[model samples]
Target chain A: MTFTHQSGTAPASTEASVPYLRLRAVTKQYPTGGGVAGVDLTVAKGDMLVLLGPSGCGKTTLLRTLAGLLQPDSGAIELDGQDLVSVPTFRRNISMVFQTWALFPTMTVRDNVAFGLKMRHVGKQDRNERVARALELVGLTEFADRLPRQLSGGQQQRVAVARAIVVEPRLILMDEPLSSLDHRIRVQLRAQLKDLQRGLGLTGVYVTHDHTEALALGDRIAVMDAGRIVELGRPVDVFARPTRRYTAEFLGLANVVDVSADGGGYRTAAGARIPDDVIAGRSDVVAVALRPDCVRLSQTDDGGTPGVVRVVEYQPGGVLHDVELTGGARLQALTPVGLSYSIDTPVFVTPEWSKAVPLAD
Target chain B: MGRERVRYPAFAICFTLLLLVPLVVVVATAVNPGAYIKFPPDGFTLDWFTTAVETPRFQSSLLLSLRIAVIASVVGLALTIPTAVAITRGRRRLRPWVSTATVLPLITPDMLLALGLLIMLVQIGMASSLIGLVLGHVLIGMPLAVQVLVAALSGVDENVEQAAQTLGASRATAFVRVTLPAILPAIGSAAVFLFIFSFDNVSISLFLSAPGQTTLPITMFQYLEYNSDPTVSAMSTILIVLSLVVAVVLSRLGGLSHLAGSPTRRSS
Candidate 1:
């Protein structure tokens, strides 16, 4: 699939309504360094906005600012037209699911779920029914009598989710809630979590360092780097077409090479001649991102870029090949399972030109 | 069968004998027929036991020690809760200094602390008073309580408290409801330790005792100064029995292991 598109921008919300959550020019500086700076974002009602970045990128700081856990040095945060900056964390009526699960070890699952209602002085009868409803929502009613420690890690996170939603909070903030679970369970829970959100029409902002989680779960992905949103768009748009070099590399488009326009073609760093068709009609294309899946391999000289397969790794549905071009540039290609090529096998690499996304940096 | 297995039982027997010897001697001397404390067959009599129990000075001093221990442990525990929370959760990185300063009173000689406290108390006109004794005991008991609490508090995730607060709990309510219950076992253990620490304390009490307001340990030490009688031995036996009960209860509360720096038994 060739991804040919112009520079990307955040699409208008599908509902065409006012944003439910807004952060404007939020900056928090630390004397010892590594804090968020000048962050601006918006999430329409019922949207699941994901903040994805590496460690120390201040995704957490931004989330904390929204939750009123950390006061930003400058800027405003508004949720549902009310200024969250002036709101105390406890009064914000926002629930956060931490990576630690944060279940009360002393309390039984039912009491843990009912904690939010109890804090609000809800009558016992009302609190109990809501608590039971929440347990059934997460399918943990059978384990309601068990303490948090007695439950498995995945069960505990479900309890945390139940506890978070039972309050019917204004906005839910999840800080890598599923990151602590094992891979098999994480995927399963992520689908259910999204379903729960949509079923309730809940507005949420989730932070995670895992890019796959961002691409898989986000209604709209905000790619953050160095405490700044480098790019913001829907998952399909961002993954298929990234405008910056960082976004392409971070999103697994790893075959990025420096290029210079020469006549009607562009000359790659390793001296390979790529025709103007891959340039996407850009007069100032300095680099290109060739996704591994976009490249194809063959045993014959198919007039494609010639390279030797240095490594071939068999994956479930396909084989991943790392090929070193004759011009000394290396590119990775994924082929179907039966396409097996051992090491040092000379192969033709055909990167689909239309799918080769150009980078401005 | 194996040398390693054989060595373990041998060490266990030796350890048991070491603990039992003093207890057996104390029990024997408490029943000594002679005026002086003695082991072997001096003939058995319960006269000294009655004398130790019936004596007014002993009775009053025991009551005084009980009162001081309860007061000091309660106040010291209340004081250290904030200190522990500050060191464990404070945004600043002064934890090293704060932690070291908290335990300083534990390592500094109790006698020196008593002496310093006495001089300061005299300046404030509180010398040789019950307040002086309690002040000294709190200084002694606070370090252990703070250590237990800091370990317990740090084991609790900040997110747990945040989870509560975000659910509409005020800051104080979150701590009292979520955090306090999570570390309740450690708090129980810390309280038990502080109580026991102040109960048998003599070094600080001896220096700080008001006239005629001495504690049980001070009274025992004073009685032994001139008399070689076995009444003190009888009192020692009674105390040994009480201590045995306290030790069992302490173990049940997990105080003994907690004193050895056990962080938490709960899984993360």
Candidate 2:
């Protein structure tokens, strides 16, 4: 079968589109203070919500809570408009692909895939057929009889995915499933997984510390920091208009300028007042974040901030210019390689105002 | 790399000689034509083996010991596998206590446990019977079984069990299907230890066993105390050979060293 993955978005036919799952103020806490605290979100059917964050940021805890591995302390979890707060894990009809691919070492690949079906008491013939189909779905039909140890790491991960999807669960949880893999393998598996998720039209919750993975794979991304979601939105929206400084800086390598109002616009550290519509009050101190792609180097463009190129480092596809402003503050910008200027060379750095976002405290 | 000719250390050679000298002497004394404990045999013969088999007292005692050891080991296995699993899979706080408690049998003095059992068994009117002997053996053997099992449990990748659970197997199913197979070698080692401990137990049987219920070790003690003969030497040699056979068999299944107290063993 051809791989199919429809880009998840708010469908036009809202009347027919229902949420697959919903977490209503779900809060999970441990005695040690390391758990998800008061999370509220709804996942549309077939939507992949990627919980992206640093380590110990409650992404895994949230995923576990969703999977019923850990119950929320004081909130309701609903599946298809039905309350699942009291439901046992096995009966939750939710599957989880653990961070460590937990393949049974003794059982054959086929048996591992067949396990959930057997648990649900599927008949012998039907279970065998579904197992074969599941293996084929993961492109492991020829490896059905092999033990997990016999397969490569990527293959074992695929088996885990297959075992999860074979049950046709209402929702699936993956906890940094690709973090343990080599970069190349991770890329390959991510694409394969996205395709499989779309083809199956399964709702998924993926947890990872990798912002790139979140950007590339999620229909909606939730940027979590210190057990709370600092920002959650479409990947483009969150990256383009981060509501919090941590979210903005975390999504990419960013450069920030502490700006104060001067005249009709904001004056940067270099005393250059860039034009903007957002007003700053006496109590409001603002930081402006600019992505590298939004900053351009100019040797003679007198319209922008005047600075001296203090250092230039050659990167793989580009060269990074560390420009020192008149006030002794520094800003970094990446330009294509071979676009050159010597250190101590006079230059003007221009920020693309359209790409600049005023960060929340 | 240069081909290096390795030489055995002097201490290693001395240790090997120190252990082997008595072993050789015991074997020689067992087969000696003269019915006495001697380093050199007057002539080679199978008379001791024949004598050991034909003597009803020795034969019955051997059977009793074998039966007691087998029962104790099997019972110990039944208790240890589940307890070890519970302890390993338990909540963090419960785990430490359960683990330490299971090993309490190993840490406590054997004479004290034997005495405690003796007092309890006498109150229950079970002392000086095969049941009492079996109970004594289990008390001595269980800790070994638990130790071996815990070591085996530790070697298993917990991810394997989680995988099974996610694949629709219940926690119990995952244990039977995944955890059990991974720890089979550890279980084997535990079984061997339990059998050895049960077979060699003296204090427990001293408090528990009646005249006919005496195990081979107990009977050997009685025989050695009465008469200094080649019979006791022959028995000790046989027990040593049995131990070696068990070790070889276990190693064949998987290297026994892997099942021994590996660093990973402590965690599980």
Candidate 3:
């Protein structure tokens, strides 16, 4: 299966020479070394940037820094060409939707959405209209009078979103806003959020570990590991052709195989010769990241390499076979469910090597 | 019916009667026509109530006690809330020491605490004055109030306040608009405990207040030392009614339920 980018997508609005949001070597370090390291990034106007990472990967610290909830130890943050690091959190025209929703328990849904406008000293008439519009956007218009405790988890999170956007903040920061909901609700809300983000042309910086969420929502994805963005690209590019093994394996079901420059193509120790067009003249390419879908297992002896299937795990649409070559190297191959293979079955592995992503040493 | 099924309700009724029996006897004696405090009245009359109200000493002491209770409770609450917030948000090390000190007052003998206050205030020449009485009452009420407030402040979600700040509320505004309302029930619970504590206190008043200006409890203790009339019972009935009013207010504010609940919001 191939991952494809959505076609016919608009560029939204990009006006200034500088990116709408720019971070210059932002750093916030804890003594425990778990905080965000020096990081630099940029997101254009009306674009969604997703920071994807595992726990303790500093994605949250970075988001909080942007929201002004956290002060970076050292960095320059600019939004709309204005300095943000010097602004207090309250004075900053940025909003965040927390993972826990964080709705004021005492306030009703309407009041919760209105809270931001009220704090900004909006008039009562304008506040009511904006709150109604925000609540309607989240499909929570009828539940406006209900207290947060009375709402479902999904509903409360939507209220949080409404509250964040009601302020029409210069930048919106969301830290795994859907992580706390049920899987079904997460999927549903994720779709609604994507629609809202695109329809409103919102500029957002979302932090999530779920790759699907990042792909569906972010115009650009930043894959972080160990407090650093190891790879930054669009979701399609980052997933289909990662420049590094860290991001390729972390983001997709890609196998990193060690290889060396051989006669016509790179050859793995397993005696598998992968023919990537990009490696034709490269002498320094040492490995290729192989997506399971890119490699195929067949019953022929000379398809590409000879291997014995060691494990067979069945999935809905595909069957995953782990094959060990004569050189003792193991590689994963995903085939159609109909092309089933039992354990210990000798199979010829044929990889579409040209589609394989060549990784730098 | 099984005894196990009846055990709790039986004990409940017994406990309730044990409480009401005293209230009934006091009310009955306050209306008794006899010259001494007695229950199961011979002939009903409210002359004792009139006599209790007419007595200048009773009037002054009761009024004085009310004034002290309100002032001491309000002042104690103001000090207690900030102190609790400080201890709750400060270093975790500070919490254990403060929590231990608050627990100390509950275990120490009342007379010992009163004695300590007397000596300290007398040295400053504040003993036998209203200020001394208020200080003594505040010292006792503070622990109860602070314990509740500290628990409430810490139990609140810190992120809720941060969310407010992100929505454009300043730190002070966030606390006032978000955290304070979240813990309002706890505040009401603490206030009730402090007010009743100061209102009914006799040991502190006995040791601190001047003879003529003693609180109602202390004044009654002295009155019964010589008088055999039912005036003391009459005053006691009124005090009980006043306490009932405060208890009603506490219930309206959800104070009783709040005090019983663990100081934490039910996480979704």
Task: Itemize residue pairs with steric clashes in candidate 3.
Answer: none
Supply the global lDDT for candidate 3. 0.85
Best by TM-score: 1
Give the lDDT ranking, best first: 3, 1, 2
Off by over 4 Å in 2: A1-17, A260-265, A278-285, A298-317, A324-328, A341-348, B1-17, B93-98, B123-125, B253-268
Residue-wise C-alpha lDDT for candidate 3, range A182-273, written one tens digit per residue = 99999999999887776666789999999989988988899998878889987888888788767766775788888876676778776667
Tens-digit lDDT string for candidate 2 (A1-361): 1123343532322222576688877788888877877888878877888999989889988887776667788888899988988876667788889877777666788988888888899999988888887888889999999888778889889998999998888888999999888999999999998878877777789999998788777888998887788888888888777767788777656787777766656777667554565433333537777877678888888687789998888877688889987778788888887787789998988877556667766
- What is the lDDT for A128 in model 3? 92
Report the TM-score of the second chain of model 2 against its true counterpart.
0.87
What DockQ would candidate 3 receive versus the native complex? 0.60
TM-score comparison, 1 vs 3, better candidate: 1
lDDT (C-alpha) at residue A15 in model 3: 42
Per-residue lDDT for A59 in model 3?
Answer: 98
What value does DockQ give for candidate 1?
0.70
Q: Note the DockQ of each predicted structure.
A: 0.70, 0.41, 0.60
Docking class of 3: medium
**Span of ten consecutive residues with least summed lDDT in model 2 chain B:** B259-268
Q: Rank the candidates by TM-score, best first.
A: 1, 2, 3
- Sliding window of 10 residues with minimal summed lDDT for model 2 chain A: A7-16
